[model samples]
Target: MKLKRLQKMSSFLHVVLKILSVSSVVIAIIVFFMKLFNSKNIIMNKLESDTIFYFQTEFFAIPDNQQYIQTEQWILVGVAIFTCILIAWLLWIASLIFKDLSTGFTPFSEIEINRLRKIAGLLLIYALAPQILYSVLHTILIPGYSFTFGLNMSFFFAIIFYCLTEIFRYGALLQKESDETL
Candidate 1:
């Protein structure tokens, strides 16, 4: 009965994750195009209103007067869209894992273990890639723009997932042994 409940919950979660993943993609695309076409007009209006819209960094602020700020802002938008897509991809992977669980596969099964590892790897990439790219591009493209790189919670989660993968591997081995002895 407990297993059935778990399976039902996993199925529900799987569906939810899949929906969220698709939605993220759609939203990212919409945002990207909006930024692409409307950014100049929006920035110009904000500037006229004296809204003091500037791209501020830890070290310095590039005000709207800078010729390259718009280009930099566009690049930032692209990065944000890329990150959103990456998140969507991660959600899709998680949905697949949940789908496996809903199909009555044990957590210790090979498929789950592999999927967990993939999630871990992707998490690590997700954690590091954006920061590295942001730091590099900003420092290089924008004068006097310096960004400090740091690890975030997703990195820790990646480590935890990797540990979980090993635990699941051990459990699978033990399960195999128990089944053989039965």
Candidate 2:
């Protein structure tokens, strides 16, 4: 593709990504507040209608003498909202990087390589965030929760980004050498 057309396409994509990121954040905030209010309503309704009780367990199966009572919701909405924001922020950063690279510079620029590195780091974080959040939520909300983990395809994208970062770094180094020799 022609450099000028490529530049235009990249700029267009950057704008689109920025718009998406902003919209995602706004939607996430809206969803969080809405869910919080909904959960509160649910909790209130439950509290008015029934008795809530939780027995203290000394082990997985044994209930101890201690007992507790409450009517509340764990409200996973916050976690979901935060995850949306996190992903949106990553998209924003990516858009910024693409915008910067969309100028009339070669792809092997040092700036491009650094941006790729940042993207790689973000991808790795994105891959890990859900697992970490799941473990935390499980421990907090579920009694006697066992350790659970599973690898998914998203991890492959993380690995792909890491490899791309290394490849970009190598390309930047070679470009620098070529420029110096010229």
Candidate 3:
């Protein structure tokens, strides 16, 4: 029956979400440490190679003076690694939300509503955080460079999540009213 199928699907999703949450945490930790330790060496090696071979690095242009470029690249690598870990953490939190939803947690519940709103706000931050980090980096690291700012598609997703939270609030109100009439 449909109910049985729904139960099976929910259980499946619950299991998957739990796995994803754990894996995301592990992966984020691994990536954070790996990048933290190796990024400097990696950047150094690439810069050395690029200087010797007269080639440009893909991530950024190698300006004249290897020492100054090395310092700038180090900062960039650190910021990029931090950004990667942040995104993974966000995904882990998202998995937590989906996990509860799959395990019969009501969307209209206060706890679920709060989680949804928190994610919505995080999504907005997610949209903006990297730009702010990069802008600051550019201002500090790259002299005579103009600052540029823009929002990506994640802002749209944040808006959608916010709307979903409001819809859930309305649903909860309606459910409470119906319960009162019973």
Candidate 4:
């Protein structure tokens, strides 16, 4: 009964994740084109407005003589699009895992273990890539910008998923031995 419920839930979540993955890719594409065309009316103006908000929130004071650099704005938009793509990729992997769970009779299997490892690798990349990209671009585009390093929740999740994959592999091996004995 519990396995049935889990399978049903996994099926539902698989559908949801698939939809979210596609939607994120679509959003990333739209953002890319908006940035590519240099849409002054929409994306550029929005970035200008967001710069004020960022300064106000971070520094608690808005600079009166702050100049808007189009190159910096472009870099920020590129990072945003890259982040969206990464999110979509992660969601697609998650959807595949859920699809496998929904269809397979046993969760502790070789395919599922491999899928979990892939997710863990992707999560590690997702955690670090945007920060690295931003620092590199800013160091090149903006004067006197030092490299920044940070870690977020995704880093921790990557470790957890990798551990889980190992555990699942062990379980699969144990199950196989038991079945052979029987």
Candidate 5:
């Protein structure tokens, strides 16, 4: 029957959607961990170079024999794993937020939704600013990378990412309505 065919189609679509969602989540986590590792490497390298300079020049009084390796490779690895998990959790939370917003999406709303919408808008602006700047400067600087700009780019990405979290929050409201109808 047409009903059974439609059910089969719906089930297939649902599975496909779940696969896409899980893949996106995994990729995002991988990206976060990669960024964490790279950042820690940069920090450790800078510190090592500075320690070497101090030993040679400022601390000529003392022998340049001490190894001042403050950061361990293991620490960076652990941090990367932790950060990736945190990002994944935030993604789940954002979905909840979006679900909530979806429930309140009637064009004519006189409640706190407007305030929340404004808040979301402001956050989007904040998140996009650095990305915009990074693109402009990267185009100009072509070869050289800006440390400050890099940090801003990462921060901006994080913000915009969690912003979608509201999707889950808003969507929950609609889910409730659908459940009640059943």
Candidate 6:
């Protein structure tokens, strides 16, 4: 029965991975086209809604002069997006790990949660190396500190982390049950 459950889980994971890959590609294509068509407009809008100059306008402070989002800042944003996507991808793979650990695709326990947390931390550090390096360099480019990417990516990670935690937490319980049975 356990073997059958694992097999089913493997099949499901295959399907989920395929869906994620297809969707990611489709989104990239759409984003590419949009960027090509409206690159200037997007830059113009960002400049128009430049929140940094809040006092310049009563409602919204548009940068009076054209200014580019700094290269380092751009890299930071790129890193944020990459990190968010990486977390999402890892969580997907985690589903498989949980299933493999279980007779079924069940949740893990507190101990397992801590283990996954460590893994998550490692993954975060790996993903953040580039951002950290660029931020350090950015300090050299800009004499003083500058605005960084907002916590928007954190919002997405929160949801993914919670869901994964819940799933793995259940696996933990089952794990305990199996140990007791043994």
Q: Best candidate, lDDT-wise? A: 1
Model 2 error, position 131 (Å)? 2.2
Whose TM-score is greatest here?
1
lDDT of 4: 0.75
Better of 2 and 4 by lDDT: 4
Q: Considering lDDT, where higher is better, how would the candidates rank from best to worst?
A: 1, 4, 2, 3, 6, 5
Order the candidate numbers by TM-score, best to worst.
1, 4, 2, 3, 6, 5
Give the per-residue lDDT of model 6 (tens digit) for 122-166.
454543443454456455554444333322344445456656767
Please write out the lDDT profile of model 4 over residues 76-117, one tens digit for every residue: 788888888888988998898899889865777787788788
Residues 1-182, model 5: lDDT tens digits: 86555555555554554455466568656655565667544432212221211221122222542332222233333334444444444444344334433443432232334434444544454434433443444334333332221233434554654564466446656766776899
* Candidate 6 error regions (>4 Å): 1-14, 21-39, 44-67, 70-73, 98-115, 118-143, 147-182
TM-score of each: 0.82, 0.75, 0.69, 0.79, 0.28, 0.42
Question: Cα deviation of 41 in candidate 3 (Å)?
Answer: 6.6
Q: How do the residues 16-133 of candidate 1 rate in per-residue lDDT, one tens digit apiece?
A: 9999999989988987788778886533111112212223244444555377778667667766777788889989999998998899987888878888898899899887776567
Off by over 4 Å in 2: 40-75
Off by over 4 Å in 3: 1-4, 36-65, 141-146
- Per-model CA lDDT versus the true structure: 0.77, 0.64, 0.63, 0.75, 0.42, 0.51
- When 3 and 5 are scored with TM-score, the better candidate is 3
- Write one digit per residue (lDDT tens) for candidate 2, span 65-175: 122112113324555566678779878877877697577677787777777777777777765665466456645554544233444455667789879888888998999
Candidate 3 per-residue lDDT, tens place, 105-145, comes to 65577777877788788888876675567556755676534
- Return whichever of 4 and 6 wins on lDDT: 4
Is 5 or 6 the stronger prediction by lDDT?
Answer: 6
List pairs with backbone clashes in candidate 3.
none
* Higher-scoring candidate on TM-score, 4 or 6: 4
Give the TM-score (vs. native) of candidate 4: 0.79
- Pitting candidate 2 against candidate 4, the one with the higher TM-score is 4
Error of 4 at 74 (Å): 1.6
**Reference-based TM-score, model 5:** 0.28
Pairing residues by index, what is the TM-score of model 6?
Answer: 0.42
Between candidates 3 and 4, which one is better according to lDDT?
4
